[model samples]
Target chain A: MLKNIQEWVMVFLIIGAIILIGNWVGYDILPTAAIPGILTLIAICLLGLIIHRLLPFKLPSIAYIGILGFVLTIPGVPGSTYIVQWTNEVTLLAITTPILAYAGISIGGSWADFAKLGWKTIVVGMCVLIGTFMGSAIIAEIVLRFQGII
Target chain B: MAQQLQRLWKDWRLHTLVLAIVLLTEMIGTHEVSIGPGLILLLPMLYAVIIGIALFFTPLVNEKQTKHAEQLVFLSVTLLIAKFGVQAGPALPKLIAAGPALLLQEFGNLGTIFLALPVAILLGLKRETIGMTHSIGREANIALISDKYGFASPEGRGVMAMYIFGTVFGAIFMGLISGFLSSVTPMHPLSFAMATGIGSGSMAAAGLGPLVAAFPDMSEEIIAFSGASNLASTVTGLYMSIFIALPLTEKMYGWFRGKKDKNPTKIPSRNQRRCYKLC
Candidate 1:
């Protein structure tokens, strides 16, 4: 658990540096201004991980992290205003660029394995990916329209 | 802890390449190229992945670097989700107001099996169809299949294949498709946002990018809705997989394959690890 905490903190710091630069270049948000926001995001994320590790039962660490973020930034909560204000400076796009980059970088290693799966597998894989997203979107649209929410 | 820190430091080459990719792509910024009725919206993250794939095949990158890149995505994506969660916090009222739609949208995830299962069978897939078409073949789905059928089985092979395929292409395809769909379909951007929560981190981010780009006015709401729906999916997905997705796919697979016996096997308790990767 401790090792994972260390690893995640280190990776976040690395990615955080990359994100700070991306924020500055892309959004014109200076790194000096975004540093506290990035740190708060990092600290809350690690706290969520630590909380999940300490829990007796099993649940995804994402559940914990998402909940922590939601709780920490909600209104009337102590420090919630500052939490929201600080994290507000970090552009969402800046954070996701490296993630998709890693996603892309990892693809070639699996290209060999992917080729072994055959054409039928390719067709089915695309189907599931499309179905998963389009299906949900179609349903959400229908339900939201039905509920008069959209 | 010190030893693990040393191991983390060894991925420097991977991080440097990723940093370079991010900076260059951001410098190029957002673009939209129209084809027919739809547009292929190209964002920085989209280019980052494309360039990364292009670079990976070249001798400039190595196998070990690729492995570390994959590991780093799983480790670091939590931060992205953290950002989304924080963004969604104050907009809690919007998420709560549209609560039923958010909850109902989860059942939309089953559309994977509904749409993919018949096609998978028609394309001549066998029992493997059950594993591949079920739940987009993410880390949890892999564990469920491995627990029930063992990784050595045909079903295990099916899930693993789909997992690799999703990891490789799901982000790029999803980003493109979501962008295209948002532009051409005329559905509200929020609908596309809910759809983005289909249980993968990088893919969800990819899908959300273009919508927020096209509809800058609703960018905050779009980001918040995607974040909330994604959190909803993560919380409910495991139970939904076991009780609904897995079994339903199995039943449908039998019917689609024209098999007589309905009862094949019972499910085992799934052994899940910290896996956010479709790979």
Candidate 2:
């Protein structure tokens, strides 16, 4: 358990450093603000972990963190402006890039298992893909048209 | 819990290596190619696939390293989702205003699952495979099915296959389809973004990428809606899958086949294991 905690600390430190460097090079936020912003994110994530554990229903920690982050930025909340300012400086794409990359590597790692699933799997996948795309598009068209957003 | 934590920690080194490689690739891609807006949206998944394939062939990443990368995925997903939630915070009012439409659109996202279930049954798939393929295949779906039914069950195998398929191709397909849909269809960008959020973070990103590129002006709002929609899908979609979709699939299968297999195979309980070492 101690080793796990230590590894987590290292992971956070590495991620924190990357966020700071990205901010500096991209001019997304000032160096002074970057640390606080990243720290705020880390704290929120931890809080989310606690909340997820406490809940009776199984929920992903990300749901709790997202809700917390959103609540903190509401207009009337204390420190809302500061949180918004700091968060605003962080680019969404920058955060997703590494995550997506990691996802890619994970997928690659499972190639052998994936191949074993056979051609039937492809047909199943394609069916899901087409169904989701068409369903979403059809729903969106109807809703947007009804709402006059189209 | 201790064992789970240990497994998560064991992969930290590999996670760090993967992060470094991702960063380097992003830097090079940004510098070398001003990929047109249409193509730029595909970069993340494309780069991920390229790096993944390269790593798959290379000796540098062994099974242990791959396991580590897989373990670290939740961290990245959590960060991305949280950031999205934060971005979506201010747009709460907009989402509320569009609530009814959004809800209906969510049902639409699930429509495919219902469609797939019957077809899968008619195609002669087992009940387990039918239930697995009937829903949007994501990590949570895997855990849920694996916990309820042992990993060795046909349902477990079905989800495993779909999970692999989704992980490998779902995002890429979503990116391309969203881009195509936005151009050809008259759907609102916000609707498209919201639709993209049907459960999976990568799929959400893939769908959002094109919409954001197409309507750069509404990027913030689009992200907000997508985030909120994704959240709704994750929370509500899980229960819906557990209660409604799975059962419905079984019923539909029976209706089509004219018989029901009351005794679905149940494997004896053992130490729960992930379906794939790297997944």
Give the whole-model CA lDDT for all candidates, comma-separated: 0.85, 0.68
Per-residue CA lDDT of model 1 for B18-115, tens digit only, reads: 88998899999999999789998999999998899898878878887787787778767888889888888888888888888889989999999988
- Which candidate leads the pack in lDDT? 1
Stretches of model 2 off by over 4 angstroms after superposition? A1-9, A19-35, A54-57, B1-16, B28-40, B118-129, B143-153, B255-279
The residue-by-residue lDDT of candidate 2 on B1-279, one tens digit each, is 546545655566665665666556555443222234323345444565558656766776777666666656666666667677677767777877778777777677667666676667666776555535667777777877877766776778888888888877777777677776666656577777778877887777766766766677888888888888788787788887788766666666556655444565442323333333224
> What residue runs in model 1 are displaced by over 4 Å at the alpha carbon?
A1-7, B1-5, B259-279
What's candidate 2's DockQ score? Answer: 0.49
Root-mean-square deviation of every model: 5.4, 6.4
How many clashes does each candidate structure show, in the order listed? 0, 0
Alpha-carbon deviation at A139 in model 2, angstroms: 2.3
- List clashing residue pairs in candidate 2: none
DockQ of each: 0.66, 0.49
In order, the candidates keep a fraction of the true contacts of 0.77, 0.48
lDDT over C-alpha atoms for residue A96 of model 2: 58
lDDT agreement of model 1 with the native: 0.85
